[model samples]
Target: MTLSVKAVAARLEIGRIDWSAYRAPASGGPGLRDLFLGLLDANDESEAVGCSLEYRLEVQSMVYEVALPAVGVILAAYAEDLPLWVEMEFLNVLHNIITGEPHRSELELGNFDLVDRCIERARDGIWVMYSRLSKWNSDFLLDVLEVVDSDRERFAVFKAGFYPE
Candidate 1:
């Protein structure tokens, strides 16, 4: 479902809710999902950052903390580092394609492949992390607790998932 930024803002105001309240059991489930998807899509399009108010409400309800580091890592892993690495690899590929010379170091080729794999995995990891974050939508305090408790686990999962496959 395509959600306009204005539509999201309207929903937020209509509910008389803070982003944290979207996690309340009283909140309807579909509403939360739609908001999450909308926010994700916006982020994907570079139209917005992290989560929208609607998304924040859903996440806050779920007891998750929407923090910078977590968001930064995901953005960097996919939008920045992956693309940079891909560009570098593309240059190498172009050189090879033009020169008709085999790359001397298998390590270089392997590294390029590894970086490509890392980008794919990082994309997947971000999706999983977002899914987990979206699961709750009522108890802001609880979500914060859960995020804190799972901090290391979440970071480790991201690292392992994003590492070259």
Candidate 2:
């Protein structure tokens, strides 16, 4: 099910596609932001273990309204891949930020520096997992949406029907 980036770009309806070689920036850019659409790569046939794109958004970026078509598409296709533990972590952090929970307490308790560091790490971890399963190729993504038609299902059926299960 692997596909070239351009094919993905086309399927995702990205009119202008760019395929520059990825390079790590020397240092973090000030006021520069990016919205990445990630694609998950499977460790085997059934389970996803890694991704091609991981992005972060600054707090100020949230102020403006934007339509992230890729995010919606990816989420619809691969929502099942989102692990529960990750969901829990996301919810916890979101609750803390919204209600001024433990995170605020830490800030007021002279752990401001430590809290900031933890917040940054947590942001990285959450975004990595959130973006890890995104991709283009709407057809393949739709194919994945077919619950009974996966390769893993066929393999399992073979193991049950032919070999002892």
Candidate 3:
């Protein structure tokens, strides 16, 4: 089920929410966190702001504070048709959080399903080429995650149950 950016914003109650309360220690004025929230296209659903490789340095420097609401936005966007970039940076952090990465004990992730959806998106040709799956050949980011296979046939066997017909 695909959703619009406005729909996601409303579901998260971003309009009425105060971001300052959720600010992380590394978040400076209008940090990547705010950028992540601000990029939500409440008026346009066809597209929204694109995160870049530059976001990797900023997001990683911020200690993946983007994991909470920012990652939340990333997850919500996954169910949408809108294209996104550099999402691997955030997804990488989420994977670390799930794997109990040090200095990430405070993170509480409840949606392991998105990880599955990421793989599904790759399988379905419904995701941007710059997202996580692309890095399998380019940067090998998936090596850090449980899924390290770049070959589709092999991955199909390795992660058989993830894609349900």
Candidate 4:
């Protein structure tokens, strides 16, 4: 489905969360946009300093602490009118998060749906982030463990052929 505010609202179950409270002030605060940018721009935490944020692990602290909660806002922001470069960045980041590791376990139901859409787009030759993602050969196990996350994840992972049913 096309990414838009309305679509984001419905798909993400948006408006139930106070997104503003997590906005990164000039001083920096918990925000998914910033985290997504950091992942897209820099190589890692050490290099991301100053460019986007001061990297640190805040388990309970508010530096995004985690990205799952902010996926809605992140997607909504993407649907908004962003510059071309910014839009591409968001797409790339979303693709990476859905397809790559994000230091987390299984994806939420909503995010999992997004993954389904993305994979479909790629396989259909509309877009690509390793269409052979399901192909069992290169780093397949790690990909399954890192991206699959849980029993609920089996649907997508199974379709991807990460494992036999």
Candidate 5:
């Protein structure tokens, strides 16, 4: 499944949507570096400095919490193939949370090199963080994991000469 808002809504069985809340706010808070560092910091207590947000991305409920490293991992892992708009939307949410500002720039979603580098840098952290994700995020991650498994299966079949090109 694609990571569109509509797809997420359908998966969540949401009936209607209000799009305004997902719009990016004006940029004013911290920069991306601080935002990412905050995510990676394990000592940050949610009860003290938590920014909990509830968003309906096209109708699906996304209760996002700042300081959840898994959220960053999931976004980075799925960053490569998503549509540009979807990638922007994800970044907008993160920016909103971090800097209290909406994202005004677009990132090249196809550039997996940065993502790969980050993954290599945070391999163990990502692994530990994945288990700490909330159920909603974990479910979404499972869906993507299924897609990866399906792709692996298809590739294996092709290698076994099941289909001729």
Candidate 6:
């Protein structure tokens, strides 16, 4: 079974989303764009007052986390080869949410450069951290790489290997 938006919604127990309300037609909300831009620019500042202000703002604006049941299901289903593009999209969405930007906002347009960088970092980290686990337990990392390379389609259904036939 492939993970669909409807399936994700059901899993999250969220009522039907108003698609129209979520629609981003372009050239909307400057505040959100500015916020995202600022978030992207934010660096580790040691100034006590500035840091305190930024922290307060972040506490009020940041999303902290997002519920991604669909992404989780797809990853588990295609553990043999995790789709990089899909995973990147999921990460981008999470990043946007964390920055206090609306997931479906027009201002939250896809940032391919940032997405690529994040994917590369994630791949490197996974290899470094899981290499021993892969060697001892199974070829999980290899399977993930294979799945990511094989799946080219966006938002496709991924059936778990253990799913009933």
User: For all candidates, what are the clash counts?
Assistant: 12, 1, 0, 0, 1, 5
Candidate that beats the other on TM-score, 1 or 6, i.e. the better one = 6
lDDT agreement of model 5 with the native = 0.31
C-alpha lDDT of all candidate models, in order: 0.31, 0.29, 0.39, 0.38, 0.31, 0.29
Candidate 2, pairs of clashing residues: 38-134
Give the lowest summed-lDDT range of ten residues in model 4. Answer: 56-65
Candidate 1: segments with Cα more than 4 A from true spot: 1-28, 43-165
Please provide, for model 1 over 1-165, each residue's C-alpha lDDT reduced to its tens digit, 9 standing for 90 to 100: 444443343333334333343222233333443443344344243553433333221232221222111222233322322223222322222222222221223233343232233233334344433333322321321232233333567655544443436
Q: Point out the worst 10-residue segment of candidate 5 by lDDT.
A: 56-65
User: Any runs in candidate 5 off by more than 4 Å, and if so which?
Assistant: 1-30, 47-138, 147-165
lDDT of 3 by residue, 33-56 (tens): 445544444234334445322333
Model 3 ranges off by over 4 Å: 1-13, 28-33, 42-66, 86-165
Q: Give lDDT tens digits, candidate 6, residues 99-125.
A: 343233222555323323323333433
Order candidates by TM-score, high to low.
Answer: 3, 4, 5, 6, 2, 1
**Total colliding residue pairs, candidate 3:** 0
Mind giving the per-residue lDDT tens digits that candidate 4 earns over 1-165?
Answer: 444333344234333554355422234343434454443344444655543323321122222222344434445544444444444443444435346332222232223343444333333321122332434332432342344334445435545555456
TM-score of 3: 0.39
Task: Point out the worst 10-residue segment of candidate 1 by lDDT.
Answer: 61-70
Query: Candidate 1, residue 118: CA error in Å?
Result: 29
Residues 1-165, model 2: lDDT tens digits: 455432253234322223122111222122112212222223232342232122211121221011122222233323334344333322332223222212333335554343233333333333233343233222222222222123566534433443354
Pairs with steric clashes in candidate 6: 80-143, 81-146, 81-147, 81-148, 82-148
Total backbone clashes of candidate 2, pairs 3 or more residues apart or in separate chains: 1
Q: Give the candidate number with the greatest TM-score.
A: 3
Candidate 4 TM-score, C-alpha based? 0.31
